[model samples]
Target: MQLARIHHLLQVAILLAVMVLSIWLIGDVLMVVFAATLIAVILHNLAAMVERRTRLPYWLALSLVVVVLLAAIGGLGWSSGPAIAEQATRLRIALTTQAHSLRGQLNASTMGRTVLDYLPQSLGGNQAGGGDNGMGSRIAGSMTGVLSSAFGAAGTLAVILIAGLYFALSPALYVNGLLRLIPPGHRPAARTLLLVAGRTLWAWTAGQALDMLVVGILSGVGLWFIGVPLALALGVVAGMANFIPYIGAFIGAVPAILLGLSQGTREGLLVMALYAAIQFFEGNVMAPLIQRHAVQMPPGLTILSQTVFGTILGLPGLVLASPLTAALLAMMDRATPPLDEEDRV
Candidate 1:
């Protein structure tokens, strides 16, 4: 029996090593798959709602959900793609011009010139904006690479949607298969834990979606009122970046600040103030309201998890850190014993 136990331990170790190796080798692909799984969960919840409302079969409800989602995306793209592209073009020009202007400002004094000398050429010091520098030509040269990257992104998105469809349509199949891996005595407990985790994730996802929507709308309106150029594009960036928590707000704000600087120092300061106000509203009002219905993680834990995951897995890991942390917490709660009233005191 001891020899058998040792053999089992060795087998488990080998399997663990192989799993780690495989994950490292295909981290990007795995991230895409993980993202698809999250999407699938969200879609599944939507399908369940449709099923309840329409009294449709499970499969039919799932299909309807998928179709509607795809239609909405396609329609949005068809209608807004050109406007977004146009705004993005303006954004690039604004950024380039602002960079050149900053370079000139920095070259005005000895200290400024020293700073400029240390700064990278890509940021447009004396090296750029020269007659032979050809900013326009450099941008043109990069268009092919941009197009290729766009194509790659589109292909990855396609895979995500297709995989999401399968997972959303037959979530039970996958869930049941996974449950089968558990020991018979623990299967019931495992099922219960899964249910708890699912509910937590669903709540978190729904709340996050609402938060993103509110932030996007508020940002666009605020920036527009402040007379910021590319308000729509900037708002979208802000909304998307909000997914990463504390660090995200600053990341989203940088572009807006630079664009404001293009106009003047006063405008730049105003833009900075506007973003700070927006973040204040989001943190105090929006997040607390959402947390009432969703899991509320400690700010420190969220930050720590993001830092660790970001170090290990880069941006994709950082983006997923919160949700993954939530899921782990949910399962851990299930595994832990609840304290009695005396213990609590």
Candidate 2:
């Protein structure tokens, strides 16, 4: 019996090792597939809505929705292309100028010089290969890095979008395939869990959209009222960044504050104060309101999810963490049995 138990333990260990190895090997593919699934979920819901209202076939409705969405995007881009391009250019230049000014100020102060001296040479753009044109070279290298990252991301996004279309086209096929992988005894529970997860994800997505919209509008109006340059661009960035929750707020605020600082210390302080007020209202009021109707994730758990997933898959993992957590929670709730009266007592 002892030998048998030891053998079983060894087998379990080996199985776990294999699982870990598999995950390590295919982590990128897994993330891509998961991202594709998220897109499919959104597309499926949209298609369902169209089908229900028009009494049309699912595929046809989905096709029409896709076309209309593409056309709408194209129309919007056509009308606002030049203005948006100009705003983006201005925002970039302003940020770069502000950064240089801040650096100059830092270099000019004795205390700042001390702090700067302690920093890495690479950060100062004076490392090897930096040469006489260190700043220019650094800028070139940074732009190259940005372009490469963007190019890679665009390719991955293209793959995800194409895969999403396929998944949305025949969701039942994939669902049934997944069911087939489950043991017969557990299929029913699996199906129920899937339903729960789907519903939870939908609620989370809808609420998140509402949250982003409110943040974007409020931020834009606030910045505009303060007479901040590139207010619209900053507001839009803030809104998009808010899609990531806690960390995103700070990420979005940095740019706006930097621009404010470029104007004056008073303006910077005002911007900071405004951001604080907005985030406070969002966290205390809007978040709770949204959570009550949508999904409730513990703050610590949300942060842990973001950290772990971000460590594993970078930005995509970080952005998907909250939604995935909600889905997992919903599945867990569905899977768990209610406490018996005796157990409760």
Candidate 3:
């Protein structure tokens, strides 16, 4: 019996190793699947909320949620699509212009000239105003303009949405089937693990959504009040980037501050101060409230997980890292009981 248990452990270890290697070697499909899972979790929770509150059938509630989401998206696009597009264009133009202007100023000073040498020449056109200048041209260029779409293509997006919908529609089918694979005695613990993970993920997602909305509102209102150009566009970028944790705040702030700097020294300082204040509010005021139900992920471990996952899985990995870590930590914490050491001998 002891030998048999050892063999089982080895098999489980080997299987886990193979899964890790597979994800590292060809992570695209896994990333797509993981993205779908996130979508399903979000949908399932929202539908559950709707079902309980309205005393509606789960399926009917889910259907209504889907329809409502689609309609909200369509309505927003119809009403504000043109304005968003215009703002995006303006944001790009402003970044390029400022990049060149900064480059020119740097070229004028000795230390600045030395610093410019490390950066890519593409940020600045052949002259102050010329074509072929986009902020995303080079990494050695400005950071803010480097934001790329995480959703790879239309087909992948469609697959994610469809798969997520199917999963959300019948999540129990998958969970129960997975539970069936476990040993009968272990099934209860496995179920507990799954429940903890799911609840953690859902709470984390909810907290993140709230954070994003607050950031968007604060940034938009603050920038507009300060007379920043492309305020709406900058706010949108900031809010979206907040999804990534600490690194994201820096990513969202650079372009706004740089553009402000292009206008004047005081403007630049104000933009910098604005972002600092926002970060302060998020970390001190919002984080505790947000973490009330969600697992409290330490700043250090959170960043470490982001680095590790981001390295392995790329953009999708980076975006989901914090939540994934939270789920993993919750599961680990609940894995066993704390008790006196056993004396089986």
Candidate 4:
């Protein structure tokens, strides 16, 4: 009996060492894995819904979901690609001109001048690469870096899609394989908690997607009504940035505000107000309504988790922190018992 207990301890230690070493060795790869898992979970839920509605086989249902997603993406791109490209060009020109003008104004003011002096020379349009002729070289270097990053991103995305499809199609197979690694006595509880986490993630993703859509639509319409240039592009940026939580709206709004200011002070003010109002509604109304049906996280806890994860893993950490926290909360709920019935009443 003592020998068996010692052997079990050895096994546990070995597993722990392997896990820690794997994490230390390929942390970025783990980020891709976690992201793929989340996407797979969301796709699984959609595929399940499709299967129910159509009475299709599981694989067929999953394929149908993928097909629909690809079709929708293609349709949207085909319809709006030209307009977005044109607006993006105009936005770039407007932002560059406005940024230069703002830098000039800041350089002219007493306090602003001091701030600019202390700021990096790069902010003042001084190239770090040095010399007037180096501008062409700097641009070339930047283009190369951009192309490299684009290719890297494309490869990562392809990996994620393929992995997610596999997980979505054979989730139970993987889940069972995972369960086999646990002690027999604990597997039941682990399985139950896994289901809870899945439900929480599905609800969270659905709610967030809805929120993104609403914000994008409202922002686009609001900006268009106010005669803001490139409203569509700004709205799309707003929607995408909304994925990041607290600071996301502000990040999305900055470009719009800058572009609006390029037009006039009134336009800038109007754009700022529009974003503020939309954010207020989202925070006070939409979020609460969604959370009531989904996961209800304390704002402070959520923000704190985002900060810690962002520090550790950068963008992917910031993006996945909330859902991961939600999963942890679900596990805690499963592990902890409720108060006595009398106290509950």
Tens digit of per-residue lDDT, candidate 3, span 63-133: 99999999999998899878988999989988988777777888888888777666554544233332446
> Which has the better TM-score: candidate 2, or candidate 4?
2
TM-score of 1: 0.80
Query: What's model 3's TM-score?
Result: 0.84
Ten-residue segment with the worst summed lDDT in candidate 2? 139-148
Query: Could you tell me every candidate's TM-score relative to the true structure?
Result: 0.80, 0.83, 0.84, 0.82
lDDT of 2 by residue, 1-345 (tens): 999999989988998899666544555566777778888888889899999999999999999988998999899789876776788899999988887887788889888877777766656532334465665554344323332355587887898899999999999899899999988998999998887877887888888888888888888889888988888888888888898889889988989999998888888988899889889989999999999999988889988998877765556678888888889888987788889899996
lDDT of each: 0.81, 0.83, 0.83, 0.83
Measured with C-alpha atoms, the lDDT of residue 103 in candidate 1 is 74
lDDT of 1: 0.81
Clashes of 4: 0
TM-score leader: 3
Give per-residue CA lDDT, model 1, range 1-345, as digits (tens).
999999999989998899776645555566677778888889889989999999999889988987897899899889997888889888888887877777778788798898877665766544444353575444333322322355576876787778887888788998899999999998999999988878877888888888778778887888888888999998888888888778788888898999887778888898899889988998899899999989888889999988866655556668988887887798888889999999996
> What clash pairs does model 2 have?
none
lDDT of model number 4: 0.83
